[model samples]
Target: MPDHQYLLTLKHILDGLGRKGGLEDNLNGLLATMARELGYVRCFLAITDTEDEDLKLSLSYSPSKADSVSYAPGRGVVGQVFENGETVVVQRISDNPNFLNLAFGRTEEEMARLSFICTPIVSHSRGKPEVVGVLSADLVMLPKDELEGHRSFLEAVASAIAHQVAILQEELAVQKHLLNQGMAGLPEAQPPKNFVASSKAMRLVLRQARQVSPSRATVLLRGESGTGKELLAEAIHAGSPRAERPLIKLNCAALPAELVESELFGHQKGAFTGAYQNKRGLFEVAHQGTLFLDEIGELSLDAQAKVLRAIQEKEITRVGGEMPIAVDVRLICATHQPLEDRIAQGKFREDLYYRINVFPVFIPSLRERREDILPLAEFFLEEFSSEYDKHIRRISTPAIELLSMYHWPGNVRELQNCVERAVLVCEEEVIRTYHLPPTLQTAESSSTEISLSFGEAVGKFEQELLVDALKKSRGNMLQAARDLRVSYRIVNYKVKKYGIDVKRFVNSKSRKR
Candidate 1:
């Protein structure tokens, strides 16, 4: 009877795929049917992300909201199936050490009594079978032989859905290519001015931002400090229909707790001791525009309640006045810390979290997107050089290597500052290794062997010293020699060896006159 039921379930899923509706809809319906007929309480179909190759939860038969959860190759049982192109059957989920419950977050009590089975969804379109995804389901614990039979049944189901998965992959690949081409070919994609997205990780983030930009949905930019959350917020607002309206920004952590309410909502005369005149808050000032709240996790609980009210009601009340003022503002929030942890600690409101997380975009860290480092460095170098009236042309190859190897803890903001400083200290057309901060010289920070040789290091230091002395002496080699307590011949030799132009400094001084 069990074998007959398994055969019937497979026939139903294959037949349903032939019915009307889109590919995704048919696949979802197939999953639901499998779960119901196979006596499983939950089922999930994870498809491979075309870009990162991670297993992304595509469809499920559970009630939980679809999250941004993904599993790298060989991360868990589901990942293992996708990684090795094999099937996994856990007679008891709790006893399997490799079972990492990253998705669905089943409780330990429930896991103790459940059996899990996962099989790769293999497509044979290209002559050979290729694993395109994984089909996983959780069922009540049964006898060992029964669990094995269920695993074999799931493998058949995976085989049946392989054709639909192949078509889905092709459609997705075409859509992704078109989206990237559209972004690359159009100027509208560059609304976030001066933003550099050279890495695949960053490009993925840009795609997400573009998809959500045209709507009124609230956007939550989650990442570490200095990762350019404000720039992303600008991109979203600039792409939205609210581009012409004012884009108001406020850092929740920058202001004191006492002034947060006044800053967010407006205050009337005598609202507080210093509230001498009527002040329009950010919400009111951003009417029909976009309001970006940075470091939202730092907001006080009381302030959180008021902010939630403003978001939920689409209006705000003056601190001293009772009448509510209506405002039509799109909100974009950013936070370095995780709001879920904050909620667990009673620091953030769960309700507000849901309201703001309508569209969450995770910006990868600088170290994670190292491919973008050189482009961003060149950008900042050009910007700072023009600002400071320097003629720095390019960064040396050794300098580029150092920049790529070091881990940027402060993220893009830190990298920008680093490039700016290097430009300030650079005396010639090319920025060299010594121009970077000392922190980057350390092996641990650079994550490699010492980049500069002993003689190369000495030469860089000597060159920098020569440039400083020459600047003070106004191109007088004799005076520069005196400043360094060295002979004029030695100074001239060092200057010539480093290709330092003394007449440029003289011309610069003459121009200053």
Candidate 2:
């Protein structure tokens, strides 16, 4: 191979990375480019799992039998390169004992004519060269001199794409972390106070919040209403160095448009009809602390200008006064509205948008993070039960199913209100399906439940009723049958049909009493 061909291959790899596509697609595109430009039959990119220290195949030039395959450190040639943080070249695949041939399953004849080269993709983002992944390719056996040069070229390509590969590795790490947790697993780590992050989406949001908390960079929280943008802003503030100082919050939309400037920047005495005395604005009040502006998109163009000036200059002028007051305050803005659309409509300033979007963290809606619904519901249940002086202990199975299945359009706020309403009307210790709002019980809301047929729904309800009766009767079939207004034979048949464990309910009753 000529030196120009190697340079051309590198150029093609760089071009492929710049194409518009997902990380996986772009990475696989790189592999495809390598296979086409350099006469290689197969190319693979394997990412190292941060938690488990295993090499998992992430991208392939051609479809292979390695979708589920992984190599433990030092287990195979790929693993050896990853473990040693060095490139490995096998002149002939058959000659290398470390070549496990587990991923591709190539025949013995094909192995005889192939040469292998594996290079570690090292990242220096942390100020140290660390191997994050491995890139390998197969080629027809080349002259020894040319083979050495090709190996160096492969190393160069690996170095060039290390940063991108590291980003992909971080994403994979987050996903693997989520998958390792049981579907219903309780959160083990205590996140910021009052923060519930049992779901993957919330965990990701929390991670972003924590990472950006230390910096004075402006953070824009974007999400639908009731998605806890304000809560997240508070979390970010509490984790920052400004935690000891005041965290002033202002709802930009809640204030009257005329009073928005007065509320934000304060007004000198007699500045307006309502300004009887000079009042310090939130910026001055939040000196050396943090200011959280909720519904920032609702700010008028004039207010946006002043806010942007304050952020850029780290100073603010009184509503009616000219002297600029220096304020050392970190800014966090939250908005459910699309700022981009607001800018397009000429309602918002583009410069201000860019400034506040320095570190934008999108808070996912409740529907997107369904795993959090139960935990959040329970949290609210405990709070409302205490406030109302009730003893609501837990949500019933049917109620849990309903809560999980419903699409919470209003996000956490709506869920909180729903749970509070249930607590107020729930007379029993356990909240049942009937206690939930009727909106959640609607056919449209619960459509995600496998599009349950009429008979299946009825049978599910019957089984729940039977289980409830058995719990009340301490698993006494005849007593439960009487309580449910059914005969013992029918109750027995339903119990068998639903796979109800009567003994467990009896044990629960015994423990409760």
- Computed on alpha carbons, the lDDT of every model, listed in order, comes to 0.85, 0.85
Which 10 successive residues of model 1 have the least lDDT summed?
183-192
TM-score of 2: 0.63
Report the C-alpha lDDT of model 1 over 1-513, residue by residue, as the tens digit: 278998898889889987856789999898789878877888888887778888778788875555658988988888888989999889989999999988787889989999999999998766788888998989999988888888898888888788778667655664566577554332233435479876667867877776777678999999999989999999988877788899999999999998899999989999889888999999999999999999999999999999899889999998898999998999999999989999999989999999999999999999999988999998898899889999877787768888999889999999999998898888766788888999887898767787468999789779877876787678999999998899999999999999999987774442210
Top candidate by lDDT: 1
RMSD per model, one decimal: 20.1, 16.1
| Cα-based TM-score, every candidate | 0.56, 0.63
**Candidate no. 1 TM-score:** 0.56
Give the Cα error of residue 111 in candidate 2, in Å: 38
Off by over 4 Å in 2: 1-72, 75-192, 445-456, 478-513
Query: lDDT of candidate 2?
Result: 0.85
Model 2 residue pairs with clashes: none
